[model samples]
Every structure is written in structure tokens, then in C-alpha cells.
Target: PGHQGTSLKVTDSPRKRGYYVNSPTYGGFDIMTATVGGVWDSFLGEGRRFWITATSDSHRNVEDGGEDLWPGQYAKTYVWAAPDQADIMDGLRHGRIFVTTGDLISELDMDIAGANVGDTAQVKAGQVVTLKVRLRDPAGPNANSDQPELKRVDVIMGDITGKADVKADSNPTTRVIKRFTAADWTRDGEVITFTYSFKAERDGYIRLRGTSTDELEPQADALGENPWPDLWFYSNPIFIRAR
Candidate 1:
């Protein structure tokens, strides 16, 4: 870890606080969001690269009775990297990973339910099938949205050889009753809807990811009190019973 002479952006200080950092403290209706978005791709005049980690650069140590910042206040982005620390760093530097504060979303996939129609069978023709998921965010205080509204749902489906991103309509028809998003902590009790409808031709499956996108930093919203804006995201993809 003492390779300071390397080209990595070894900043001992914290990055500027953005949307996700400020909104929670004010009880905003919208939950703050943040994503790796993408890596720098390349830095420095040469082809050198470095890893981008979502970590709590908490400078205030709890040495005194006063705590500087909460433990794990920031996200810990783990790349699907090798045990070698250098490989881990390389994986992050090349945009090969993403960080989350709440859930661990390692993989997502979808498929059709049945080849033929039957009452007890999971899949059927002339019916809409779906996939869904929910991951855990270890560094988060859960979803802190103003009204707990999910805005986007992605149905990543098809076989291992073929895949596609199907954005579904947020409605009750495509949801798992009393599960997943339904039990999600949307305290406002608003009638948030989620749905994924598509006519099936053969047997297959789908993966769903429910997302709530809000300003990462409210103080920066174009029409809000903030001068800078940031983006927030939350999603958990799951395999659904499609018949």
C-alpha cells in the first residue's frame, strides 16, 4: 500500500461531498444516488491507470467522545478481482467493476418458464413472464428516499449466448406480491408501480433490477436548493417464474 511513487491518484483527503452525501441529512423525499458510471479509462500522458474505490475517506477519527463520521459512511466498491492486490487495482482502474452501498449484485439473468402451456407449469404462452432481484448495500443506511418511489426496472433476459435489457413498466401486474419491491422501505406508502410484460415464444427466464434514481446531491439540482447535482441508483435483479 506504500507505493506512493506509482501513478495512482493517491489522495489522502476526501472527494468533494456530492448529492448522496447531502440529501439524507435533510430528509428529502428523493433518496440520493451514486454509481461508478465509468472509470477514467486512461490517465496521465502515458498509458498508466489506477483504481477508483468507493470508500469512506472518513478523516475524523472517533478518538474523542465525539465521532467524526459514522463508520462505513461511504461505499466499498469490490471489483471481481483476483486475490492479487495489484490485479484488484487494475480491475477497478479499467471500469471492470461497480460499487454499491447497500446490496451485493454479483450476477443477473433471465429465461422463459415452459415449453408448453399447463395449469401447474411455471411458464405458458399468451402470458407475460418476469424476472426480479434485490441486493444488499453494506455501506448504506438503507434507502433514504423522501417518498420511497422506484423509477426504473430493468429486465435483463435471454440465454447465456444472447441477452438484452428490457426496461419494464412499474406497476403491480409484474410484481411479486408482498415481496421484493413491495417490502422495500418506501415509508411514504405511495402506490409505486412496477411491471414487466412481454409475450413469450419459448421457454426462457428474465432478470429484474428495480432502481430509484434521484439527485445525488440535492444542493446542486438544477431547480433545487443545491448548486451541484449528483445521481443515485438502487436495484436488485431476480429470476422470475415465467409460464
Candidate 2:
């Protein structure tokens, strides 16, 4: 799971896998909080960059006996490549992408001292850098027949200490460094902007995650229960190197 620059496939439901995210017998972790978080943290612990993508895993519709949403109906992965297929594949391979669920967010512009996602920038050790983010929720009704409003954005940081300092199963040094609330900012239309600065005590990576629901905490799902209407998005990590 902690593979090198590999893209991790995450989804809220994996029906045929015998363990959905809310399954009572073997499920408790939301893919965003548990699966993707754990993978990104572990990669950072190994001083490597990792990427993530979401899928609907739709084989057929409910009328046809499938329990998954149609592809691109509720979740999407946007890749920042050129029109060429090769370039698109290259972009996906290089982690220039973001994932969204229920069309909660339509656009995200993130930069770390001007370095965009999938880019690494050089800076002095212990340097303080500003992370700027601009995001916009979809302007109109989404798949759920309601416009999703972003409620919170979380900034997660993880120290890249190399493989020598990493554990096989978990990365203890990774955590959410900051959380921006919608109530703390004045919105313009559907867009919101956030800026924060942090000292790069050592080499590390930062990423963003946001949700549309007001539930600050992840609620446990009852056995066989699935909440498909909740909306969320996750951006790829931006790496930093100290000179």
C-alpha cells in the first residue's frame, strides 16, 4: 500500500470485495480518512511521494443488480494533462490530479510558494512558506439535486525522514496541520480562498482535503448502511525539499 510514486485507488464502496467502508463485520474506516491518509502518510515517512484517485466501481445500475453508482456520476478524478492520450497518462502517472465526490468541488488551485502539485521546490531548512489555496464548489445542482457547500478544509502535513525512519505498517509523524472553516472566511459566490504559513522544520509534504457536510467528525455507519450523498474532495500532495 505504501508503494513509491504509485497512484492509490480509493472509493467509498467496494461492494464485491466483501467489505464496504461501512460494513459492520470488517469496515469502519472511511477511505479518505483511513485508506488515503494512511497511504500518503506512509509514503511521506519513506521520503517518497504518492498519489490518489477515486472511482465509482460501477459494473451495472441498481436496476441491473449492481450496487454502485455509475462512473462519473458521483465521483471523478481530474487529470491535468494535455489533449493527447499519452500526455493524459503521463499526467496521471505524475500525480497532477484531484478527486471529487458528488461534484462537491469543481476547481482547486493550490500552490506552495508558487510550486504546484506534483512539483518539488528547493528551500532552506526551517524556512517558512505560504500555502495558498483557492477552491470553488459547483455552481449549480449536483448529482444529488442540491448544490453542495464546502464546510471545512483540512491541511495535512507529513515529515519526509527517509526509509530509515519509517515503519512498515504506519507513519506516526503524519497529521492534519491545519483546518480552515467556512465560517471563518467570507465567500465570493461559490469560491473560497485560504492561506496559511508554516515553518518547514524539515523536508515534508502538504495536501488538502475538504468536505461539504457540516459533520466535522466521521459518523459510523450502521451495518449495511451507505451514505452516498455526502460530498468530499482530495488534492494530491505537493512536496518540499530542503537545501
Candidate 3:
């Protein structure tokens, strides 16, 4: 009920509005939808690399006359940390996490210089930074009984202008900086690795998102269409401080 669009309003002043679209929740379960990344990039531009996680808040099962998927059955948040509870908490607090829908990907790793997600890298402005990304799709079928294929990956960047410059809506300055095709990457047994190099012009953040669907652009969902066929995965951002 709270997730309904009519009951929601996008706002930067969360203290006043008491609510904001945490991430775009449109077209049902289209996890690769650009709307979510757009919203996240906006916050990044405001110097807040807001953390995001995926969960199935399944209060009741559809078989029991409810409309929700079981927890970890549809979406899951993976945190890279030790087995200890405290470490897991620390990982989440630091934004070292990734989310997958329909189990599209089993592993996703990214690094810049020597910093990984949730870590900040300091470098001189105009210096080129190399980003390395490794991803692995599940070799077997997911819950939906379909083996997903990695189609493409996108790198999104947002310039951090500080909280004082934050806007109340979408940040026009943030955008997808690069897109990579799976065919160009090194692959072996469902795993693929790729690298990107870019010159730092200013302080910013970068994140990754990939999809199994071949649609280059997000498609509008028809009424009552199923969203389980499309799978997507998103990674937390890595901050960059260039002086």
C-alpha cells in the first residue's frame, strides 16, 4: 500500500517530506529499469552515495491468498564481509553490497585503484583511473527455471557537489558514463571480466548495473505483464576524491 505511486512524492528534504522514492519502484519488477539508477545518481550528485538493498518483504504467500514473493526467493542483497555479524553490519553501513533479481548474477566485484565499493580513492584531478569489474552469472537455472544470459553492463557516474548544492529532484549532472557488451569481455564458465579507464575531472562516484534482457532501452510494461523473465543486478558505488 505504501509503495503505491499515488501515495508517494519525490523529495530531497526527507526531514520535511518524511518520505521519498528510496529507489524507483515502477513497472513492477523490472529491476534493470533506468528509473532506479536515475534516482540513485541524483543522491550521489548531492554527495550522498545512498545505500540500496533488495529484499522480498513477503508478508504472505500467493498460495495463501497473498501477492508477494518469499524472501530471498525473488531478490537478495549480497554483502562482501566476514561471517561475523558485526562485519556484516559494517559492510552494509559502508555500502559494500550488491543486489540481484531472479538470481541473474552469483558474483559481482569491482575495484578502482586499490579501493573497492564503499571505499574512497584519492587522486589528482585529470589522472586516469582504471576500473576493473568481474561478474558471474549462475550456470544453472534460477528460481524461475530459466538460465539467464548476461547482455550488457553500464557504468553510472555522479559528480558530488556537496549537500549544500543538493537538489530536490533528479540531478541532471548524473548519468551513465559507459556501457560494455558481454561479447568484448573475457569470459569462461559464466564468468566475465572487463575494465574501463577514465580521467577524473572532479570528485564523483561510480556504480554498476547489468541486465540479462537484451533490450537496449527500458521497455514499458503492458498491463498485467509478468516481470520475472527479466533479471538484473546492481552494485554499490565507489567514491573518488580528485584534487
Candidate 4:
């Protein structure tokens, strides 16, 4: 029961055993697609939550080798069903997922219960926590990918200590700010969100980052690369407890 070869030798045998012995090496050939999203966020620990599916381990449409990977090219986890031939594999095993390489997002939702972002659900004092995004437009835009550019939607709330300089035209679509709080919004979509209301004494945790078109530079670029083309979406951080 040990035959997981190729992908260039399971991504080149752990950097060839850390250069035979030198040590200090990184990159695990995309680390099995990032451990399939960190084994589903490490089994949704802590407060317990789970919902993510976008598999294509199709094995070349159930055939032979199929030139190794090619059936939807990667990505499809749009759960929350109502039209299917089998509930799309039971809504991807019950997790109503979403992930696209070509883009076809029909619906995306996020509620912060008692929101906070420039004062919406009270809790003032530099308050700010309102990230709502909805997208729908992708019936046809393919040619190997690259036609989904709906950038700038980052509303981060924790873990960077401090950062401010959002002036991509002095507020284009929407991005309100006012920090010094701590966690309470786990995560959202349309591209990135993580808030939990930080400030029981300021520990950390809260996120939101959805801006693409390769980010047009000057916004935490840092050698930006890949689909990170400005980071279209990422929200998964809502942990705070300082009592």
C-alpha cells in the first residue's frame, strides 16, 4: 500500500532529503495541494466547523493515466444544492463548497451576527466589520483561464499588528477601516474575510482579502505571484479569547 508516484517523484523526494543532509529546505511540490486545504482545516477543530469541497481527483475521467490530471482542470465545490443528478455527490459529502478556476459564482453569503465595521451592530470605538460580497457572471469566459477580474475587497481585522495605506483611488468600491479591536467573524467569501473583534487586550485573529487583477502593485505586493494576482479571496480567522 505504498504507490503514490509521479508529480515528479512525489515532488522530488522532500527536496532530495534536504539536499542529502544539509537540511533547511522548503517546498513540497505544492504539498499535496496544500494537504487538501490542510486536511479540511485540521478537521475543523476548536469551535468545530466544517464546509469545503472542490475535488477533481477524477483520475482522467475514470480512464487510463489520462495524461495525469485533466477534467475540469481543477476546482468545483459549489454546494447548497437543489438541482442535481445525485446532489453532486451529495453536495460534496455535505459541505456546500465553492472554488473555481474559470469563475461561475452564483451566490456567496456571510453574516457577522452583530457585525462591526464603522458601527453597524454597535460596539463602537474605531469599530468596523461589514464585508458583504456577491458575484454572478461566468457563463462563458474560458480559453485556459484568465477573465475574472473583480479586484479589491480586503477587510482584514487581525494578525498583522498594524497596516494602513488603502488608497487605490481613495476608496473605490468599498473598504472602511477603524481598528483596535479583536475577533468575531470567522470568515466570508467573494474573496477573503476573518473577523472576531479583537481587543480583550489585543491578542489577534480576523481576516479578509479579496483583490485581484494581480493586485496592480503597491498593496503588500511582496513578490506577489500566481492566482494571488492580488488575492481574490481568503477568509478564515476568527479566534479571540482574552479574559
lDDT (C-alpha, whole model) for all candidates = 0.30, 0.66, 0.70, 0.32
What TM-score would every model get versus the actual structure? 0.31, 0.81, 0.83, 0.24
Error of 1 at 199 (Å): 17
Question: How many residue pairs clash in model 4?
Answer: 28
lDDT of 1: 0.30
Q: Give candidate 2 misplaced runs (Cα > 4 Å).
A: 1-37, 164-167, 217-220, 224-226
Over 122-199, each residue of candidate 4 has an lDDT whose tens digit, in order, gives: 233344434343444344554335555544443443321222333211212112233211142233333333333323
Which tens-of-lDDT digit does each residue in 1-243 have in candidate 2? Answer: 011001112435433221343332112224334443465577656766567777655655454555555677667888887899999998888888888876778888889877887777577888988998888876898765777677788888877767744446456777787889976655788888879898877887888878766655445434333334455687888888876
Ranking by TM-score: 3, 2, 1, 4
lDDT by residue (1-243, candidate 3, tens digit) is: 111112112323222111124433332333333553455666776777578787665565545544455677667789999999999999999999988877788888899988998889898899999999988877998766888777889888878866744445566676778889866789988888999999998998888888877766555443333446656677888999999
Candidate 4's error at 200, in angstroms? Answer: 5.1
> What is the TM-score of candidate 1?
0.31
Query: After TM-score superposition, what is the CA distance of residue 197 in candidate 4 from its true location, in Å?
Result: 12
User: Whole-model lDDT, candidate 2?
Assistant: 0.66
Evaluate residue 91 in candidate 1 and report its C-alpha lDDT on the 0 to 100 scale: 57
Cα error of candidate 2 at position 176, Å: 1.3
